[model samples]
Structure formats: C-alpha cells, structure tokens
Target: MATLTSVYADSTIVLGPLATEAQPEAYDLCEKHVNSFTAPRGWQIIRLATDFAPAPPSEDDLLALADAVREASRAPRPAPMPAEHRPRPGGVMPGPVTAPLPPPPEIAEGEVLRRGHLRVLKGDKE
Candidate 1:
C-alpha cells in the first residue's frame, strides 16, 4: 500500500510511501492498484519504491555500542546525593501556607452551589 499524490501544475504524479497523515489531494492505493498504475498522457509520474528491511550494523555502530558499554562499565556511580540534596517528594511544597478555610462549617445539607454570601440550595420538591 502507498500514497499517490498528483501535481497538476507540474503534470507530475508521486507514488511513494504511505502518508503518515491523510491529505485532500493524496490517494491511498493498494498493491494491485499501484502495480497497474498509469500516468495521464503528457504527464510525468515519479514512482518511489522503498525497501523497509533493516541494514546490517556497520563498524561505526559497533564502535558506538562499545563506547556505551565502556561507559556503563565505569566504576561506582557518583556517591549518593546527601540526604539534604535529595528531592523530598510532596514534602513542604510551597503554596498558600493556610489551606482554603473550611467550607463555612458545611452549612445546611441541601446546599447546591454557593456564591459570595448566597447559596443555591436544593429545593424540597423532588
């Protein structure tokens, strides 16, 4: 499966890798359609064939792996950070030191919504 994009102004058509995102001008085609595809007369078609097979690792890749392993093998990691330097998760986080005052001692049980001084209470009607 691949995406076919046409450039009318340049009279060109591109048959390439499937688009990551759909575009109004691009058409998604299956293998059969791609194989039997044709370009309009006087127009140019640029067909792109991509091989997805992974290539064998080269010497640079081996060297990079060796360097990483060497780094990993290096001795005792820097001594554990002192207790004071360690992050105290969820401890003493700075904010309004005083918590929002309790909801006015949970006034009346039927309270629905409260404004400054007025509270919309649930009506007794069902």
Candidate 2:
C-alpha cells in the first residue's frame, strides 16, 4: 500500500498504496484510484518508485521457524486415558455427584459500604 503524508511543503503526493502499518496521518489508496489521482493547482506531484513486491524472508525469520519446529517436536504429547476411566458420551461421570454450594447471605442495610464504583459488604463469617 501507498503512504500519504501531509507534512510536505511542495505537496508532492506519492501515488501508491500503503505497504505496512496504517498510520493515522497516512492515506491508503487503491491501484485504480492511485492512477486517477491528480494534484491541485500550484501544487506539484512527484511519483516515487511504486514497488509493492514483498522482500525475501530474512535469516531471522528462517531461524525462528526452525526453532519453532524443533520446540514443537520436543513437546510431549498427552497419553490417552484408559478406556475404563473415560467419561460417558452424555457427560455423565462414574463417581458420586456432589451438591452445589449455597448462595451467600444477604448484606445488612447499614453494613454495606460504597467506595467509587466498588462496594464492600460483610460476608458470612464461615
């Protein structure tokens, strides 16, 4: 993609699309619009090299990829659980089910305190 800057004094606009990060001050234009762009009166337009070809992968990129592959190969795969211990298809386990916990006790009228957007209230002692 082309990067458009407004800081130039001659108003020399680079007619191309932005190739990298989208900056707030830069304008990205498509190939069709770039060709049709025209400079205003008293302003000069300088056409810079519009090379959009991606650079070849650097040594660092190749090294990082190799390291990642080596790390992945070294990682231990989880052993499958025994068929006897596996859970049923319907999500039912083979053990005694425990009851859910009771809800917290209600806070007293004056015991509640507020600080900014947060509130502090006394909870059950246990």
Candidate 3:
C-alpha cells in the first residue's frame, strides 16, 4: 500500500510505498500526472534509501514538554476575575455590544431572472 505525504511549498504530493523506505516509483508517478513537473522544475526525488537516520526532537520539544508539565500541575480553574477587572464595552458594563443586522429583502421574481442572466454572463453561477 502507498501513502502520500506533501511536497514542501508545492501542490504535488509525494508517495510513500511503505512507512520505512523512500520509494523512487512514487516520484515517477507524480511527475507523470502533474503538468508543472518539467526538466528544470522537475519533481524532487528524495530517497530515504540510505542509512539516513532521522534527527531526534530538538530543544523546542523538550521546552514544550516542560511547559505542559507546569500547566498540568496548576489547578484547572484560576481565581475568578473581579467584574470590574473584566473586559467591558465603553470601559464599563453595558447592553449587548453588537447586534445582528437583518438580511436584504427578497428580490422580485423578474429581478431574480435578470440577475441570474447577469451572473451567468459573468461566470459567477454554476
């Protein structure tokens, strides 16, 4: 079975024959279907064939793990913020800050047909 992983910064995807090894057959398949793959901008064939061992997670991963630990240790809910300290409208509490505006009224049947023709000409409608 084959699984496709993405090619970096490109629309084309790379196919993995198996999770273990990089398959050259996959690249050839993509080049055949994708039009953009020509001589110069030809698809990159990455062969994870050799003894190329993937690098371990870097310092960022370690830091993130530590941060997760610190967060989990703290109580789930923090002290309730005072009402005065909380965000509000006009720098103070008020009614609902925003309201939904009503939608435009339905157009007349004749207007709908005219608009449909215009949309068709503009390639805006299916």
lDDT of 1 at 45: 87
lDDT of 2 by residue, 1-126 (tens): 355555466666655445466667678665566667787776676656566443578899899999999999999999998555543333556565354334434555755755435568677887
Over 4 Å off, model 1: 50-126
Expressed as tens digits, the lDDT of each residue in 1-126 for candidate 3 is: 333455666544544343555654343333233323332354554433333233467899799999999998895778898554333322443555344433334555435323322422223456
The root-mean-square deviation over C-alpha atoms between each candidate and the true structure, in angstroms, is 11.1, 13.1, 16.0
Which 10-residue span in candidate 3 carries the lowest summed lDDT? 113-122
TM-score of each: 0.39, 0.34, 0.24
What TM-score does candidate 3 reach?
Answer: 0.24
Once model 1 is optimally superposed onto the true structure by TM-score, how far is the C-alpha of residue 56 displaced, in angstroms? 21
Tens-place lDDT per residue, model 1, 1-126, is 778999999999998887878799999888788888899899998988763223468899899999999989996688887443322223453444344333333557888856557789888776
User: Candidate 1 overall Cα lDDT vs. reference?
Assistant: 0.74
In order of lDDT, best first, we have 1, 2, 3
Stretches of model 3 off by over 4 angstroms after superposition? 1-52, 77-126
Full-model lDDT for every candidate: 0.74, 0.62, 0.46
Better of 2 and 3 by TM-score: 2
